[model samples]
Target: MTESPAHTLFSFGTLMDERVQTALFGRAVPTSPASLAGYTTRPLQITDPAVIAASGLDVHLILERRLGASVEGAVLHLTDRELAAADAYEVDDYTRRRVVLTSGESTWAYLDAKPLRPAERIVVVGDSIAYGRCDPQGGWAARLAAAHIAGNEARRRVFNLAIPGSTLADVSEQTPALLPARRPDTLLVAAGINDSAVPVGAGDGDVRPDPAHVDAGLDSLAATALRHGARLVVAGPTWLDEDRTRDYEGLRFTRARALALRASLRCWCEANHIDYLDMWEPLRGNGGLLADGLHPTAEGHRELYRHVRAVSC
Candidate 1:
């Protein structure tokens, strides 16, 4: 693990935004009122939608070096990983510089410095199961994050991109664009169950996906991770109860599709040396594990979180 950062950073821009802070630091950054001499804050319009969505503003505060001017802001301490995430979050227009504060404390401040550093950030992408769509406490993803805090596992932090009803196609089509913005150190993807719900196989009436779909989608996902310099962890689809999905209308067929998706995912992960989690191996035949025959119950989320906890982000 990288050493925790001892450097304190002064924020004069979007880093002050709570959403941006959480996205970068994985926790609320501790801050205190501080001022910088010889600088002034200027409001600038940010055109990047990703930045706007994250910071919830189309305008950002920037510091301009000026004589006899003092800029008031907050002082914050961030881990090395958090610093890297912040660097990635800011656009190219900004740079980093060390400055002395009015309070006699010197800290790192973003100005216009060049950016590049290692990161330990993670993003979770998947459907309702990954989103904990039914669980009030936010399901397994939240639990996994909580576990990290309890264990002092600073090597990994998460940003959830999961959406209810998202399919592998959605992941393949959308993740490439989102990853660069999040710039996660790793991407843990849980999908394919919804895709398998579609018809497939040569039997009388099948709705499962063709193996080609899985292959193509996985290929795209893998490539997206590579493009962002992120490692990929592919988790198999969650186990399901037939009673919840159309009262076992096509139980065997759905099961087969799930199996095929898992098999293909397993093979791909193994061949690529990527980490893979098996929802089936752990939850199969476990009664009441699900909330609606589809999503996992809260207790079930705890179980899933335990599994996610094992993987090194």
Candidate 2:
């Protein structure tokens, strides 16, 4: 009598343990050294008592996609019954996936059951600061996009639609163009700096943006975003160097006005249950953060990128 055909299983971690094989299959299944392409291993915490006892370790390896990366493992040839037993041993966090190996062989392996979906698209709209006027890297939004959406290493697509000298009203105007024919993913607004600018030669009561108008603009943006299925994030304005800004291009930017706008934006975001990034404190008083009193330096842009990624991304 001839033996039945076998299923191929690729394992980079716990499944390769002889002790685990014996506990699950009653014998050590034969394995051949192999490598999985386009994936790298990450540590996963295992809580199943049986799995821990069988492998004698509480952590296991799972695969995540990384271009040009590879996971070293082995292929096990198992009979139908043994394969079924192997399936029973895996935890819920892992799901079997078909993959091509480095040696031009196809096989099955367990991967993260709930893998993170790559962000489809991200859109940024705001003022000159958002336009990355001074930062060599184009600003915080650009840096974040470059890290996530550029080249083969990219996991998503990012678009910066910010225009210099734009206000919250400008963002509202730009919103229509942002609505995707399909579905929109995320929209980040980084305005209010231009709005807060105090005209150097104007009267005491003349601030550039009317608070009421700012609120209306924000409301319009939020409503449009909700209707379009896009997640809205409002990144508040940072502080300016009052001394230097007092004479820049015949416009005076005051820290006091920036503070007030930041507070107002934060309140608006809170009232609407929206995400708001407060960038004032982190960038304030840092001599090197601001270039020419209004725009952020490269390091400042990096800082903004970090904070934006922490919440918005």
Candidate 3:
């Protein structure tokens, strides 16, 4: 009779949440902050209350383990049944593999890739959504981690460094620090909404679309991603409501500005050979999915995840 592999799951994303951990594993395992070599974290942009833009340019990767530095996360010791359940739930964009984990011990951990495409390095940079915002259950990026694990049982290490309210400019400034550390296989970037929301000049009316800035940021981000031999995935900003009422806080922008930003982003993605995920139309087209006019409620997030899964698949 064949024996089931005894495995330990190392999680760095939303799985770090105690409740989420318990729900997935049926019991909580001891968790600590751990870092993987050759990866950095950043933010994902979100506009509406319910939906967030998968913005920014922060992602985790495999590299040489540093002496002192470590990424933060929890480790779950898994039973065969629990591991099976986890595998079923995460069978999407991720695949599992073996990695020399933070504990300095080698055990069976879920790495996020098929055959674990070995890269000298890789980076994912974005805003709050990338960082995982209000969705306490660990946001989309966390889910992506799980998917990576389930998909590639051979290599399950992807670094996540998503921060909230991060702009493209922030990515440009930080890319150098991350690129210097490791060479990545894939670089995914999500940005835009914040640029649209920022008030223009001294007065509110001065707020306008800065195509020049957006263009410059994209150029730098794409060059950096390609320089690292990474495939770039650029996600457009999620949809937001322009009309504000006593019920919700909405960005007040003209239709022209909104359309222009969308067009500009689409154009840039196309020109750069970056894989673009258009989250705006799907979220806006579906009303019940959004909790408040902006962010994705639980249901909305699920929808967004579905979208990512489809594209990733």
Q: If the candidates were sorted by their lDDT against the true structure, best first, what order would they fall in?
A: 2, 1, 3
- Tens-place lDDT digits, model 1, residues 170-228: 99898987876665646778888877774333363543467678878888887777555
Tell me the tens digit of each residue's lDDT in model 2 across 1-313: 6446378989999889888888898888899999976677778899999888889989887776554567898999888888888888999877564556788676667765532222345677898888898877798878877876654343466688899988788889877766675244566788988778766776657433577877998998877765554556788987678776646567778777787788889888877656677877667888678887778888888887787666544
Who wins the TM-score comparison?
A: 2
Candidate RMSDs in order: 16.9, 13.9, 17.8
lDDT at 115, model 2: 25
TM-scores, one per candidate: 0.56, 0.59, 0.55
Model 3's C-alpha root-mean-square deviation from the true structure amounts to 17.8
Clashes of each: 13, 0, 69
Question: What is the C-alpha local distance difference test score of each model?
Answer: 0.71, 0.75, 0.56
Question: For candidate 2, what is the lDDT?
Answer: 0.75
Q: Which stretches of candidate 2 lie over 4 Å from their true place?
A: 1-119, 150-155, 181-183, 206-209, 246-249
Model 3: lDDT of residue 280: 73
Put down candidate 3 lDDT per residue, 1-313, tens digits, no spaces: 6344366666665455566556666566555555443333332232332111111213323222222344555566666877676665442334443344444643334343322233222356777656556577666666766666565555444566655677789877786577656445556676666666633322355344788999998888876654543455677776655542112134333334555677788887766535567767667756566544555666666667677766653
